[model samples]
Target chain A: MSESRLNVLKTYKLFVGGKFPRSESGRVYEVSDAKGNWLANAPLASRKDARDAVVAARKAFGGWSGATAYNRGQVLYRVAEMLEGRREQFVREVADAEGLSKSKAAAVVDSGIDRWVWYAGWTDKIGQIAGAANPVAGPYFNLSTTEPTGVVTVLAPQDSSFLGLISVLAPVIATGNTAVVVTSYEAPLPALSLAEVLATSDVPGGVVNVLSGKASEIAPHLAAHADVNAIDLTGADADLARELEVAAAENLKRVLRPAVTAEDWTAEPGTERLLAFLETKTVWHPIGV
Target chain B: MPQSIPQTVPAHGPDAAARLASMADVTASDAALRRFLHGLPGVDAVGLEGRAAMLGTRSIKTTAKAYAIDLAISMIDLTTLEGADTPGKVRALCAKGVSPDPTDRTTPRVAAICVYPDMVETAKAALAGSGVHVASVATAFPAGRAALPVKLADTADAVAAGADEIDMVIDRGAFLAGRYLSVFEEIKAVKQACAREDGSAAHLKVIFENGELSTYDNIRRASWLAMLAGADFIKTSTGKVAVNATPPGTLLMLEAVRDFRAATGVQVGVKPAGGIRTSKDAIKYLVMVNETLGEEWLTPEWFRFGASSLLNDLLMQRQKLSTGRYSGPDYVTVD
Candidate 1:
């Protein structure tokens, strides 16, 4: 009998500039399962890669933000639809990355899809809830509205690789912000695969760039990037977060602090993530022509 | 392969212009222009883009960044080329060009103010003593499809209206159909049209409309053709096409100027007009210019950005660098 061929494992690459490219640094680190079994090699993104991601995100910000809320909502919904179609692949990847049972992994994947849908629905409505007109004393009309805070750098939650990543990322883009996400260090395969879904979806290129590397190695460069408008520190540890916060202060970046503890990935998430990357603009126009 | 750069070529001399006009044997006939251009090297798109991407990573920092920012601001050809551009709008743009940041008079003025032929007089009047030149786009502009006489008239009108520089677009149809000499002669005619009776001429910028040509080889050939026809500068686009100036496209043009200088002893400026809208993007172009052609091409006379929104972003970033705080669009005027 002929010998059977070995399965071809895929190499997880970084997503930037709307294309999938291996890290410019040409370095890849071994990614394994929770049980220490080999999975694949993930691209070890460098500071240059972080800078490139910021460029991509900044380029994408104009089109994504200028897109009507309805259009953005449909694009987000398209992401959820694409994710639903690739359900089994994510289930397998998540199960391997986190050492969860197949059923639990499937549940995590389902929650991620549902979380996209939830954010997708909020795209058109977030503005109405957050924007308002005020009664000013002078002969002037004053109104306030929320605008995307340009490019946002997101450090995905290190533990709940899939669900937590979508939780932090979906809200940023749904509200018209483009993100450069640093995927989980230990469990990066799922986040990498999610990048595939994002590409297939209607989401514009550079709207959500995924980098698979150590957050410690990549997050600091992004935190200090003058082009990056804000950063979410959900995936960082105390010391790294503290360092990033200090660097973020250099540009007055709107930082979302890390949660106190790793929360249940399936638990309810509020509007705080959506509000995290939004900048409010109040306009005053004269009442008379 | 692109030609290797030589160590030094004497600066383009008076006779070099006569020699440059003589270097092309095929100038008199259509087939010769075709043969010469077709014989030129082909560009590997992937390789060209890779070089541009690599050069874009130079980390221009702190003091270097501040210097680059100011240098970039001074290099801007503050442009407003819309069908809806009125006298008031042109005047406003001219004012902004003279004093980029009203709050800070110390800010360096822009290199020039770019406008249409009809608005050239207004821009020139507004920028009379400011040392800011008025650059007018002619030669049927966005689309170089009009008859030669009309295109020449457009050039003469702008030059007569006190325009110091005339930006013209080449006919892409003639270029794409491989009629290289026709394209060359048209640029020559426009160059002649830019000359005034007083023996001085407005500097000529030839726009290749790189997006329309759709190939790097064509852009390279067009660049040489324009240079041989006595173009003072070669621009990448008119800012009207869907794919205006890009890093790779501009890099290719920069390489052409570098090589043209090596071959003919003539130096031509490069303007990557359109879609470059931030302080960072401007710096990257500067990086490309610095690394590809070196610091000799870093001055406003040698390099220019044909953009409008780019000025505000540069000003805002300049404010941030100076005051240590980010300035919003509110702080800058909305010209």
Candidate 2:
């Protein structure tokens, strides 16, 4: 029986609108370990797939952004809890994808879980830190508060796939901004597995869509998408980043350029990522009734 | 034995026979209705979905898209159905229906303003001379579990209150239990109740609540049943279910309407209510209508979208088309 049994390999597919779907283009690329042994075939998402993700993210934005800060915080913390339960699975996948030692991969997976918790706490308090009341000389009371900048397109960091992907993803969604994330090209299994965690973590469908494909092929379409309000170029090469930034200007999309190719993923992410995808909305009301 | 004979409908136009054959003997008895509906046709889920997916790829851009956008706006039955609906809210909705895009006066008024039964008078008062009809959802609405007398009274109240169109839900319990004649008789009763004492009757749109029906074949049967029982329009869902109007479901209804026209020479409209919130989704429905039912159903008189938030999205898209810039929610009224 053991000799006759076959291994049931997992099929990696695109996560869009909170469901797993084979790429619309019906294309897949071989995802292998650092030693060049095939692990699985990741869906080669097309421009149409990217556009569909934008539509999903946009659809999810209203409900997510309108959710109470307390609710959003609880959902984000739940993601951390779910990630902790699957620590061993991610650690092994990370080790195989990045050719890291078991212990090192375990450390990376732990940090990813910790990062989620870190961003989770920010969900409730980010508004307080970002909003302000201005003293106007006139009889009008003015206040400025932060609002999510609609749908955002993110490029996950290439190296340290698990920790880096979480580092970029948790912040954008922490502030109620829906994200369409492009997973690491070389190491997509961990990201695809992460989508499963998100689905069960009380996160609404389409709030965090993950596509596994070449960032070079998918980023341009997202950047030029009129519906996409912002783009993160952390994983793109210099040429790709420059081209994407130009395309993003078509709809005046807020572009988050990478400061360095290999920033420390385990380092503390301040308000930079959170602030990048938030719009400051100011309201004025008359003081006298 | 008399029940075995096929029922014939008077030919109001030249092509009436084509429509009656499928509906013929359908209302004769339990067995005949079952056989007629079962024998109508079997829906290939994969093929039906494949066709819908293929039609979704047609790109209507530039002038054609602008034309479709306006035409779609006119076909909207701007709806607001909540447990907390108030007269104030109904008036506000009716006002929005009349002037969808306040920034541009050229925006066409919607086809109708849909509300609950009690708000029919309020909606009629607000939309008195706007040329926009007032549609009321009756027949115990959302769920049709009420007694037949109560359901008929509900329809009568809305019609008496000056509702121009009546949207009624069919009992899915009877439908699922294979009590096809009961469902058929219920629709006919409601159709009679829509008649006012003043020699005028409200147009009747039968709601299938297709989510509860849960199958393409059921949707097709429900469509034919409603049409044969005298439905002015066949609607997809009540917008209260987890799965409301979907592309494949709407496509199936469009096909039924098309076939109904080909068979009986009687033209019926199709409305896919619920969960349609974007201009793109609305345009896709329009495309389905244009492709399935052709140019005849393209007019507001033939097609209607039972949606609420879809109106604002259409307005925003219209603004983008004209101003060449994306408009935010702040620029539009929140109803």
Candidate 3:
């Protein structure tokens, strides 16, 4: 073994069932930078891998959701801490993967970690802010708080791979939602590295499962899947967006249409984007007078 | 009992932007025509889910204009007629399009009576003295998945029943499969069917059912192909899909109708049907027509609504505006 290989930190694999496994197909598609330099081999996930990720997400949903919001907040902060340790590595991978300048990639990593920190603070509070007390005129005390919408299937954005992936997942799970997230078209490697960070970040198995494959192939399955409660299609073409909208209508699933735009990843799209995917399930204890 | 062969509509290359540009010029060439059309505006906005527009100056005043609306608005495909008690209901529905109110001012009338080939004669008798036309949806209605000869005969039957117009559905299955020219040829054959019996050939309006195609671009492409293949009108929806008569979709079709007139001098009408429930929706559609197709196409004879409940609201709103009080349910009676 060369000194470089020895000194080089390890790369991660696809996260399924809490363990990192090379794609079951044993197929890896190489992603390259603009200059054609090889970056890393990303998993060319098969349909089987997609299905496996779904199973893992379903399994982890109950316990993670049943936990107190305070406990969930600590786990989310752990992810931010682990991410802070890998800042330099992330900057290089994402910059090369996104073809952004080095400074932009570093900024994206910083924003991504910031995203984790921001949501970490929200785990215990989003429910209060989102859910409402209904003014039921004649009936009992009617209070509704936000609850996880359940196992959401997300098609992560193609450009802002790491930050976009983290932005979507952190908000979702901040309110206790589990996810089967599909990695982007060009930048799947950094997403897998984040999955490694997640595996060790004290988050329970299956809170978030990352799948790497063609958006066309994997996204349709998730959208049409009956078991999946909702789909966040934030990285698709117009045709794809319409198709998924139609398919989702078969069961009236909540659908988030893909944004047909490019932008700086770190910029805030505002709190609505975070508030949108969560269904506040407000619970209140009556005080006896 | 089947008289002809099964038919197919050949799909062709769809260049929506180019087609829209060409369809824009179908009305008149000179600057005078543009000035005249532009100067006249619609009476109200079309709040139809897809507030749509059409082509042709004198859109409201021509004998030719009525001919187009009779052909365009009076189509009811079997997709609507599949209800177990359809033929009679379809007849009533077709007649409703042409029915006018005594108190209406600047209120345009629908041109033709539309129905299934099975009920074309029924519509003919119901609208005999009304000067309204009889039209039928042939070639399998909403799906448009049959063979050529069968659709041709279906068109022939409706015409034989005194149909003044024949509207057919393109094989969306074929279009999605990249069979564009085939869809074009199928439309041509149906147009031919309109002329098959004795010397009486109905005007042909091909229903692209824009909802199925989805994008404004695809809608434009389909509208162009239908017009090029001799469609008298390109319609918005079958009232079947969730997304229908979107304002954006109508804006695109209006542009196409305008350009088609410039290219072919074949002025076309626009019909946005399905889910047009309120008076506010009707106004939005009128606005779209005024802005896109100009003043002439605003007449009932040139522009029509394949609507079930829109007429009542249009009347009610007109009544409210004319009289300070709200009109009662009996204000506009339906037979």
Report the number of the highest-TM-score candidate.
1
Error of 3 at B239 (Å): 56
Model 2 backbone overlap count? 4
Task: For residues B242-306, write the lDDT of model 2, one tens digit per residue.
Answer: 99999999999999988876676677888999999988899988989888988978988888999
Error of 3 at B274 (Å): 57
Best by DockQ: 2
Off by over 4 Å in 1: A1-3, A58-87, A102-150, A174-176, A275-289, B1-78, B88-110, B142-153, B168-199, B206-335
Candidate 1, A189: how far from true, in Å? 1.9
Q: Could you list the CA RMSD of all candidates, in the order they appear?
A: 6.6, 7.1, 20.1
> Model 3: residues >4 Å from true position, as ranges?
A1-12, A280-289, B1-335
Candidate 3 structure quality by residue, lDDT tens digits, B59-169:
333344333333332322212344464666766654455554555534445566556788877777777786777667788776777788888878788877788777788
Instruction: Please state the CAPRI-style docking class of candidate 1.
Output: incorrect
- State the C-alpha lDDT per candidate: 0.89, 0.89, 0.69
Q: Answer with 2 or 3, whichever has the higher TM-score.
A: 2
Judge candidate 3 at residue B290 and give its lDDT: 77
TM-score of each: 0.72, 0.68, 0.44
